[model samples]
Target: MTPVPGDNPTPRPAADAPGAPAPGTAQPAAAGGPLRTGRPKPWHVLWLLLLLGWTVSAADRSVTGPVVTWMIDNGVGFMAHADHPHALGGLIGGLFFAGYMLTQFPGGYLGDRYGHRTMVVVSLLWAGLATILTGFLGGLIAFIVVRVATGLGEGAFYSNDRTLITDNTPPKDRSFGMGVCISGLAIGITIATIFTPNFIDFGRSVLSDIEAWRMAFWVLGAATLVVSLAVTWFFRTHLKAATVGKAALHLGAYAVVSLALIMAVYLIGDSTGLSDLWIAVLEVALAVGLVLFVLVRKGEEVGPVLKDRDLFIIYLCNIAILWNLWFFSFWSVSIVAGAAHSSFAASALTAGFNAGAGIIGFPAGGWLSDYGLRRGWGRKEMMLTFTGVQAVLTVAFAWYLSAADHPSLWVMGLLLFFASLFFNALQPVGHALTAELARPDLRGSAFGMQNLIGETGAVLAPAVGGALRDSTGGWTAAVWLDAGLVVVGFVLLAQVRGRRAVSPV
Candidate 1:
């Protein structure tokens, strides 16, 4: 195989080849001369575009967190209404996921079939338009519709970006590249935290407080639009040609597995009352189906589906970490705010968690993963070590939170910061492992499956945490229960096998 300019070096079948590259094997370079030593590759340009797209998508999604309270204060219909704050809040928040989950597979398929750049541009433009419209909407139904639309548009960005990076980047550099892209998520959220308040305040002074929310949305939409245009204009060059024949087989397998899981969940829901245990079991089953689908459909040359010892372990560990992680995202603030004796204290705690996770945790995680990879550590070692550390810290934090004597805000904030650190670090490591385990042709679907599985935590965390809190009249038991899940995840991860040292490029 020969490396061609603007051609993918990863092994796959030729455009006219009889069979696809065997699973797990890198697609072979095109039949041409070796890459010229002096010329710049197109990957650098694509990288910049990816970074821009990721930052914008992340910022668009995260901006809601900081601004939700303000929106409520400013007469945002559903959030401000007294009828059902909890239910309405949950509905508004979950709408994003609802839109997001619906588009995952379609996005992956389109990126594989059409071109990542096209999807990236389309998704960004569509979401940006919807976000701007969200500010202008007058009624609750309108807001929900716009938010859902934004979610649907934004859903494709992450998967498409991952596909772009995987297709263009060299295998040895894949993890680090992924880390760079993932870091954009943190960067966007951090920017929102620091700047959104000021933006809101400015809009209020210039117009009205209610109008400020509108202004924020409009401004965010405009900024995203500009970035998207720039990326599309500069990075619209042709993709490196690479065979993607295996995508069909992988998609077929995923569809079969996904349908089975959905049917099983429906049957279980019908057979049993929506008991807490049944719901939890259903969530776990869905997650397992997703993981198995991705693992099983991986190309044969890459490796056996379940036989790769380390891959399976990494999957379990990731599921555990993500379950706790999602719980923190969805309910931690609500719980802490409810528990704190004072509104001020509760608000502070909520802010601390967001800041810790968004500002500090994400970068720290990426840095640690990159460091471990550079130092010749295999992904399994890095993931397991971090998983254990995260579990211990989480358990200690839960215990502290459970105590009747409340700790000082400063102490609580510190603990929350460390927890976020652990949670954020898990992402890059998990992604690196997934990339390592999957065949190149299946990268997009692989990530889709990972996210789909990880999102099951989203479904479970709220339902389970809500039930526990409702039954116990406190969050103590809920937090402790999450800690136990972490432990279980760690035990499963301990079984994964991989090279002790990083494999050479």
Candidate 2:
């Protein structure tokens, strides 16, 4: 096949080549001075800091599932009188992602127009405040409000964080840095799964049953606030601060619009007694309209990012991935416990194995992608291979859980670990491909568009899984559905023809 104009026709130099600097080796100064060595590069610090940000984000969200499950089990809080406990619990998660999804494109657009550094700090602060409020507010409506607010704040994080890593790291190390940075997600999940129930037990010592779970939110939120301060201080010199402009004001407008739409939907649902599923559909439909308005107004500048057919396929692909992700994230503990017939604590520990695998899987996938790059493999090849393998592993896991009367906890854990290894690894590869597909100036928009469409899966998976579980009277159907989505993602990703490499910005 003929190389496209401006495509890099040759493979990257082998590691032994002088042109290919080893990861962490200093490059010659842009001014052509001696190579600076021994000291850590700026991207290293950013990677560490951003990883912490992801850690906090993951922990905060991960706590919700276990907390809701506890509420249902003990007949306390919102789950006390819930007619459909599973669906209501899933709706809580779905609502958060509804707010989260609405902000994806706007947040990235703001980060692009203003500054990624500033947007990152802002996101952390907003999320922290909203999380703390959730603990303090303590009722059904207030709880929903705070979680949605938290989602709004965190929605900005992905696009900006992706930009920061890609902008700072060299081509060879780019995916690795993304992998390392996002590995915090695994760390945070492990923390939540392993420790959150313990935290609730601690809360039980001093607090009423109704209030005990609030302790988890208070602690996690406080940690997020502390991390925000550290990130602001550490990132001061590492990246440019956001430029203040009229464009920055739009961020607030986006937040207001999202909150209003969510509340409006909830109120309509309450008055008319609409189902949670219908409420979710209304929320997504309105959000889509908002997105279309934003894109049409900004079409001249963002047209390329919006129009790219390959990127659209990737966007659809991510829907399947995130559906698998949040299905597990929001419901994994319950799934594990039901399948294994274990205690809540044991199930959480077992589920942590799945989340924990990403710590290694992310970086390993990134390294392998880079290796494949040097060997002349396309990024599409690396991504699709991982996707297909993950689909198979997911199906195996689903079948094992459904078929076994009492599946071995260890076996279930191993299946989850390997399935997630491939699942998590493909993320950074996909992100790196996104960076390559758009120009530097438009990368934020490209990533924003990718996630904006992709996160619908996050929005739908929890509620749908829950509704299915309620209808089927077992987790078997939900688990199979999750497995099927992974297969769909594999097929969608295979249709992508993009093979653009990241050129020097």
Candidate 3:
């Protein structure tokens, strides 16, 4: 396999060739300690940027929930007078997943085909714009459209994030870098959980009750846009040599995917007035089309390394795990608010308390993974252990919700803390495993496929959870369903045989 852009070292000219430095004369390093190519320090900066990016990404995506809360109360529902707000909330949440779902495979392929930096820049910019737009849109249809656009950009992001991790870190320390950096996802959620309501409250002082949600979007989106531009400048300025080609082919493939999406829209049947069934079918088509588009391409063929049967099982496991992650991330506040009989603002803060658990979990998981790998203890075992703990906590939380008259808010918050602790840890382990299992050439695609599958579940879980709550008028089924997903993921993860650690790429 030809070395991909991010991981590949620059080829040097022959000693006798033109532009070669004289035998004794040495060149100066970049002002910032060293040239970025092949250096570790620049990655520290990039990791910090990733930290920021992940935080903003999580905050941007979580906006759906806080905004939906306001919409439900303030009569900003799907219709002028909408009913079954939970179901509708699910649809809105699912729409973001729908848009997010399609981009995974293509995004990864693009990163593999082009440069990871390019994808990162584009994702941040797109998400920034979409996040801002989501607040401004009033109608459910318009809201869904903007959220999906946001998803598209965000979908591009995760795969590339891992790719950048894979490119920058030596194999031994990959889990550390990926886990610690991607922990920003949790931190962002925490920030949103704690501050989203506050933003709304501040907005209410100056704006209408309904318009308060718009304020959250405006501030978060504006900040994201500024960060995106800064990231773009830093990458472009430092890595000045990157060139773009393959534009024509990339565009052609995109056209094919777009056509497939349109065809799926018609064939899958009309949306039946924004019903869940309609969106599910449409999203499925887009997902299937993306799968085909990615898998069917020439030279894009994956080798046996990627074809490991265990890989798909792991992907399925990730999907199951992500179902838990997304559902909770999207709706935990609502669940807490209902069960604890607390205010939305208060419950959001309580629910977000779990996010703080990640500050420890992420770094610890990465360190543990690296420790295991270095000692030949294997990354999969460590991943499975954390995931198993997550499954148990998931069940415990579900049980408490069902058994207790009013699940103690403190107990619920504590359970959520542990659940998220183990859950967040599982992610970097999975990423490290992917980095280990996948050939460098296929790393981006592997991550894309993993996220694609995971997000498919992520897209549906919120809607399913919400619909279940709407139908049952209780969160028992919804919370238990999350537990069931964890068990399923745990079982699949257990099936993944730990492979011996490979040398750093």
TM-score for each predicted model, relative to the true structure: 0.73, 0.91, 0.87
Query: Which candidate ranks first by TM-score, i.e. highest?
Result: 2
Off by over 4 Å in 1: 1-45, 71-76, 239-326, 330-376, 404-406, 459-478, 498-502
| lDDT by residue (tens digit), candidate 3, 278-319 | 565467656766666556664347544346777878888977
Candidate 2 lowest-lDDT run of ten: 1-10
Model 3 misses residue 73 by how many Å? Answer: 3.5
Q: In candidate 2, which residue ranges exceed 4 Å CA deviation? A: 1-37, 237-249, 500-505
How far in Å is the alpha carbon of 454 misplaced in model 1? 1.5
Which is the winner by TM-score between candidate 1 and candidate 2?
2
Better of 2 and 3 by lDDT: 2
TM-score of 3: 0.87
Candidate closest to the true structure, highest lDDT: 2
Cα RMSD, each candidate: 6.8, 6.9, 5.8
List per-prediction Cα lDDT, in the order shown: 0.59, 0.80, 0.73
How does residue 235 of candidate 3 score in lDDT? 66
**Candidate 3 wrong stretches, greater than 4 Å:** 1-40, 77-80, 238-274, 298-300, 303-306, 502-505
TM-score of 1: 0.73
Rank all candidate structures by their TM-score, best first, as comma-separated numbers. Answer: 2, 3, 1
